[model samples]
Target: MRGNRVNPNKPSLYLPCETRNREFEAKLLLACHAAERGWRGVVGAKKAIDQRIARLPRGLYISKSITRRNRFILDIGKRLGHIVTAWDEEGLVFASPEIYRTTKVGATTLTIPEKLFAWGEANATAWRNHPAFNGTPISITGNPRADLLRPELRDYFADEARSLRRHHGDFILINTNFSLVNHFLPGKSLYRQMLQAKKQPISQYGSINGLALHKVKLFQHFIEMAQAVAQRFPWHKLIIRPHPSENLDTWRGIMAGHSNVAIIYSGNVAAWLLATRALIHNGCTTGVESFLLERPAIAYQPVVSEDYDSQLPNTLSLRVSDLNTLYMHIDNLLQGNTSGQETLLKKCHAHACQHIASFDGKSACERILDSLEPTKSLLLDRKKPPLVDQIIGWTAAESRRLFKRTQLVRRTTTDSTGYQQHIFPAVSQSQVETYLQRFSTLLNRFHDLQVDDLGDCIFALSKQ
Candidate 1:
């Protein structure tokens, strides 16, 4: 549950959910884990932080996006004497080649939060070398999301997984990341937009890398290959799970009247991973996620290029060049064949260890909390700003809130520009209490922090 309307008096941890996917769950679990350890905080969507920033106290506010808007918010938070932290939800998925170079990337300047919690050593080293983060404080805390994927916590979603198995029965999950192609318009219009992007400056949205143009074709190939596989194995169920950012209607339209092929976009990926016999994808995060769950995955690359191939999960998964190859692997797995799988599995395990942080089924949140112990007194010693400073912070926070409400603020994604919006399912006060109560042993530590319910989309950690 969100913390009671930002109470400046009580110290709390603020975790903003950038997107409602596995990352959201991971962060939520962190908040719950925090509560267990006597920390009080609210987990809300990114917009929720801005809406209630005025009442927010001088404590830590955590975020995931690397956008300018978030950087602006952090700037404002600092002005009001609050600690801000950030981490990439997609940190391990893509390599920003520019981060390797001495010169800063031209796309956008890095927004170095007061504390930047990186996922692993590789990410930490990249940020450490970057010019913008010259003096920024950084900690290589393993991602909390990966903590949930640990085999021990599998019981948390066991009931949901059982329901999924009953509903989808021996299905093959095919995950797609064609959000760039299917989010807004169809192929021709989308291509035109891509051309327009190329003409524009190399901002975050418009890239010279040609990933969008290449992805458009890649999406088409995925669709064609999915259909081919479905046709060949009509007896078996093929579940096509589109990326959350993608347009579900487009996938539904493509697979209309196909009984064996079902396009589903509901439920968390973890449950689906458990329900499936095997997983298939091009180069999406789900491949790595499924790998963590001990599921076999095949990367279908009909048209491959050295420049375009994904290095992490894509390379790690068993690569199948065409539909025939994909069909062969899937058929073999379905029939319970694992004779020649040891070497590839070993490589995937090694890659995950090298790339991802701790996966020992323990709370990474604990490690993060230990890092904040030195600053815990700062949380306790929060002082009210001078009256004039309070007035200025309130005025600025309200102005930003109004600008966002009126759609006056511009938002941009990797390949598009618009007002980005997301809403998390609100948890009730009772629900929050019940969740915290489940981990009562941890809650016994913090005698000062308590949960406060601020009505109408706001909740917080408040001083008891």
Candidate 2:
């Protein structure tokens, strides 16, 4: 059966975003690029996409990740006659290729996506060498997320950074990425949940447990570092931005009694990195972003584990192994003494070049759209699924929607909708338009793009 019909003459591109602050603006920029190329770009929350996938018009679906957990969505999209492609958002800054492939890339799910996009040479090499890889043709186009960090696009976040600096003056931004152990959901640690879902076998439990233990140690060190910073610099604010999936209450509880410390998990992190005097993180993706933005990135590694620590981000940062050294580095950075930053960045630049393509000339978004252009006709000409299969898919989607509603109602305090909203708040068409306007002002492009509300926090962008 035919799915919901759009403008058949205009091919559609579906982009599902799991995290708003991280993926929304980047995907929106990508959508604008797609619209410029005369294709309809539908960008939405992942939940919305999952609920409406079967009903939406057949299109090229770009999945955020290809983990085993995403198999259902991949299968459904293929069964509904949509061309599938994917790039892992968490693949670039990983512990090791072996561990990353084991935990993030699903052996079976890797075969589903017809094409794959890589962040850089390292990512492409890892995926190409995977046992499940079947000559799927991996494109080494850097992520659109990295596109936002390019100098040309830095102006897009200028206003937000200014406002942040005004509200929180000269703050030390501490970005934590420990949701695997400190998840907002009560019994739902990401590692544990993956195990429960059989994403990895029982034999892998020891490795998972060890990684969790390492993260827990790092989590505790971060808390201590925050406390120390608060004590050391009572005049300046210490902002602790937890991971979206982390428990904000836990951070608040530990950081209580510190008047200078604020537990904030709002807005895009690029703004925070721009506004802060220096960014403090261990192995977060934000560390690399800060380096890209020419900000002082401090990797506080009080408790280090070579096996568990992500190399790229930390390597790109100014590593400090103790609280005293962290304080000294912060002091120097605050005093505008960047004597060693240039030297460190120079060394890290050669390493980062292997892992990330910063789009010195053409943007990553443009490159990705260009890559998709050659396959557009083939994707558009594919036949629709059989009527019976479409019916089955629709029924399954409806059942999932009903089950989700029920689960939402049954969730307790820690596992409630509050956590989901924290990660992906309700988005409006106005917000999308505002971002589009910002993009237009920055690049003098996307002026012809128009936003259409597609409901369920989804928006479609196309040329007016």
Candidate 3:
């Protein structure tokens, strides 16, 4: 965050916590890419990121909102000598923070078509440009989710596709689920609610128990659309599958009334798609893979969000609230009217996806695995502030908490159960202040902190 620059003539944005978090996240992304010193660069980047992200709990999921996470960031950043501060001025253009690559990997194919691959490109470049990424072994792996698409794995699903087509008698398949709405919903918050529900004895959705109002509304809209589509195409089977994490029995109990309408078992979503003549989805990247399978697909966007900057080839969205629109598309299909089919569809697919996975799914897995090679990479700074500090700021309790969380700071637990106490590390505090003060004086003396290249510092240090 020390190196961050302020832009003139830009309206400062103090959005809702979640939206502001997104904007901060988008800023400071330039430092995340390091080709060689991956972890080190990443740490340096996050230290800077933390300085900014420390401002918001807006998007932090409540269940995961334990003090431990903030402590974790503080401990890690402190140990790594990462900076923790906020900007004196916020900018209009989104300043992205560099994301820390944890051991967690995106196992689903969703990461690829969702423009995560392109995010890799941008992040990798950030690392390279970062003073931190220099000599780092880390580089972007493209899309880690593509690992399932390699040649060795290609045949794994081929037989399933063949078998499904043989039995289904030319069906139209859709992979539907609440996860399908991941785009519009905040992943950091809503997903945690779902996860928390699964973890705890209770079942809740986004601060509410038993199907959050938003999810209920989502279900209602889908049901109306599905029933309408079923009524129009009496001959076609209407199959719906909720996410694996969901116990759709509740939704199924409601759907039991529709004779033409049906729900799919968890394991069968992919198989059903392979057997189907067409695929229908909403903002799901599976549409790209479905097209590669040579099954034409439909993208349904009942709502749009800001996450669409990265798009794919051969993907088109149809926004509809009811069956009337679906009926029209079905009617067109029945009439052999695949209008604008060739040019817009095929060309867009080719144009949008430059990677081999665009035409062949195999490239995804290969690129992803190759990227996880344990090489060092210096990534851009995604410094986000400690979460609690963002929530409470410099309040007495929060300040005491933040004060104790610092690694270099010593603490004395006076209250134990009541309120833990802290004692600051004079050495660390004085050292930082002294270092900054000297750095500023030196910068004034020399006009900047630069050596000829990596180190013209020996002479400078010796001179001092």
TM-score of every candidate: 0.83, 0.93, 0.43
| Worst window of 10 by summed lDDT in candidate 3 | 454-463
Off by over 4 Å in 1: 1-10, 99-112, 184-192, 196-207, 338-342, 382-392, 408-464
RMSD list, candidates in order = 4.6, 3.7, 19.2
Best-first order by TM-score: 2, 1, 3
lDDT tens per residue, model 3, 59-163: 211010112234444333322322221110111011122211111121121111111222234333433443332243432333322332333334434566687
Ranking by lDDT: 2, 1, 3
lDDT per residue for candidate 1 within 354-436, as digits (tens), equals 66767453356777877777766577686766777667777888898777666534333322223233224455667555544
Instruction: Kindly indicate the candidate among 2 and 3 with the higher lDDT.
Output: 2
Task: Give the poorly placed runs of model 2, Cα more than 4 Å off.
Answer: 1-8, 190-201, 386-392, 412-416
lDDT of 2 by residue, 318-369 (tens): 9999988998999998888876778877777878777876436677888898
**C-alpha positional error of residue 140 in candidate 1 after TM-score superposition, expressed in Å:** 0.9
